[model samples]
Target: MIIEKLLFHTFIILAPVLIQTSLLEHHKWSKSPIFTGVLNGLATLTCLAFTYEFAGLYWDFRYVPLIIAMVYGGRKAGLIVLAFMLIGRTIMGGDILFHGLASAVIASLIPYYFSKGFWKMSPVKRVVAAQFIGLWPIAIIFLMLFVFHLPSQFLSELHSITFILQFGLVQVLGIGIAARLNEWMVEKKVMREEIIKSEKLNTLGELAASIAHEVRNPLTVVKGFLQLMKRQSKGEEDEYLAIILSELGRAEEIINDYLNFAKPQFEKVERVHIKEILSEVSILLNAYAVKECFFGEPPGG
Candidate 1:
C-alpha cells in the first residue's frame, strides 16, 4: 500500500514531462524558458495538491520540479517555479509552514545559483548534479527537524529510518528521470531541425539546377550566333567578337557552378596576364560608355 502511494505521487510529479514528450512535435513553446518555468511550476503545484501524509505532515517531491526548472530553464525559470512553490505552501497552511518556506528558500539557492553550468554537463553528470542539488532541500528539512527537537518517539514512530532513506532515494530517482527526459526531448528537437534544414538546402539545390539549365540553353544559342559572327568579321571587329566570346565562356562557367551544386569541377589552371584582362575590360567599357553614355569617366580612368 505504501509503495503504491509512492508510485502514484511519482506519477503526479512526472506527469507534465511525460505529456510534453508526447506533444514534442506539436508544442510551440514547449522548450522556452517561460514555458519550462510554467510546466515545472505546474508539476510542483500538482505534487503539492496530491501530497501524502508522512511524519505527521504532508510530503511530496515538489522540489524536484523546482530543480528541473532551474536546470533546463535557468535562473528566471527557477524563480518562477520557486514563486509557485512558495504560493502553494502559503495556501496549504499545513504543519511546519514556516519551516517549509525556509527549507524551500535555502534549498532553491543551490540549483538557481549553479544552473548556468548544468547544460555543459554530460547526461550522467546532469542526473548526478540534479540529484546532488535535490539533497540540499532535504538536508534543510532534516536540519529543521533537529532544530525543532521533536520527541524521539515521534521521529522513530512516524518517520522510521528505513522510510526516511526511501524518501531520499525516491527524490533522487525523481530528479534523474526529469533531467533524462529533458535531454531526450532536446535530442529529438535538434534532429527535427536538422531534417528541416537539409530539406530546405535540397530544395534550393533543385531550384538552382532547374534555373541554370534553362539559362544555359539560351546562352548556348547566343554563343553559336557569336561564333558565326566571329568567322565573318574582320580585323578589330574580330578582336571585339573574341572578347565577347571569352565573356560568354565565363558566363557558362558560372552556370556550371550552379548546375553542379553537389560536387564542383575545377577548370584547368592557366596563367592569366593582368595586361590582357585590363585591355579586355577597357575595350568593353569604352564601347559601353560610348554606346550607352552612362559613365562620366569610364573604368580604370
Candidate 2:
C-alpha cells in the first residue's frame, strides 16, 4: 500500500516534468528569461496542485521544479516560481500554509545562491548537492512544526524515521531527474548550434570556390591584354606601363588571396554607395526571377 502511493505520487509529479520537457523541446520560448520563468512557475503550480497525501499532510516535488527553474533559468525564474507557490499556498489557507511559505522561500534561495557553484561541481557532487538542497525545505517544515508546538499527532507523524527517509528519497530522486533533464536540454542546444555552424562553413566554402573560378578567368584575360600592351609600349609610355603592370600584379595577388579563402585587403579605402550595391543585387535577382517565372508557367499558357 505504501509503495503503491509512492509510485502514484511519483507519476503525478513526473507528469508535469514530461510536459515541461516537451515544451522546451518544441518552443523557442525557453530562450527568453521572462517566458522561461513563467513556464517554470506554471510547472511548480501544477506540482503543488497534485500533492501526495501522507499522514494527513501534503507533500509534493514542488521544490524540484523551482530548483530546476533557478539552476537553469536563473534568479528570475526561481523568484517567479516561488511567488506562484506562495500565492497558491496562502490562498489554500491551512495550518501548514506559513510553513509551506517559509520552505518555498528557502527552496528558492538554495538554487539562486548555489547554482553557479552547482554547475562547476563534478557530476557526483552536483547530484549530492541537489539532493541535499532539495530536501532542505522538508527539513525546514519539520523544524517549524517543533517551533510552532504543533499537535502531538502532527509531530509524531513527521517524527517517524520511515516517513523522513521515504520523503528524503523522493526529494533526492526528483532532484536527480530534474538535474539530468537540465543537462540534456543544454547538450541538445549546443549540438544544434554546432550543426548550424558546420552547415554555414560548408556553404561559405562552396561560395568561395564558385567566386574564385569565375573571377580568375576574367583576371587572366585582363592580365594577358596588359602584357601585350607593355610589350608594344614606347620609352615615354614605359613608366605608365610599369604602373599598370604593378597594379595588374596586385590584382592577381588579390585573386590568389580569394582562392586561398583569405580576405582581400585594399591598399586604399574608398566610400562605397549602399544604393549602388542594392541596385546591382536587384538587377541580378531580377534576371533570375524572370527566368524562374518563365519556366514555371504552363506550356500552353
- Which numbered prediction scores highest in lDDT against the true structure? 1
Task: For residues 1-301, write the lDDT of model 2, one tens digit per residue.
Answer: 5555655555644554465567557677656657666766776676677666665466666777677677767777777878888887787778777666876787677678887666787666676777677776777656765666555766466456576677778667867776776666666778999999999988887788788778888878887887898799888787887887788789778878767764544789989999999999999899898987887877677
What would the TM-score be for candidate 1 when compared with the true structure? 0.75
Model 1 clash pairs are none
lDDT of 2: 0.71
Candidate 2 regions with alpha-carbon error over 4 angstroms: 53-57, 115-129, 145-159, 234-301
**Which parts of model 1 have CA positions greater than 4 angstroms off?**
23-25, 30-32, 53-58, 122-124, 150-159, 257-301
Task: Give the Cα error of residue 179 in candidate 1, in Å.
Answer: 1.5
The lDDT of model 1 is 0.81
lDDT at residue 167 of model 2 (Cα atoms): 72
lDDT of each: 0.81, 0.71
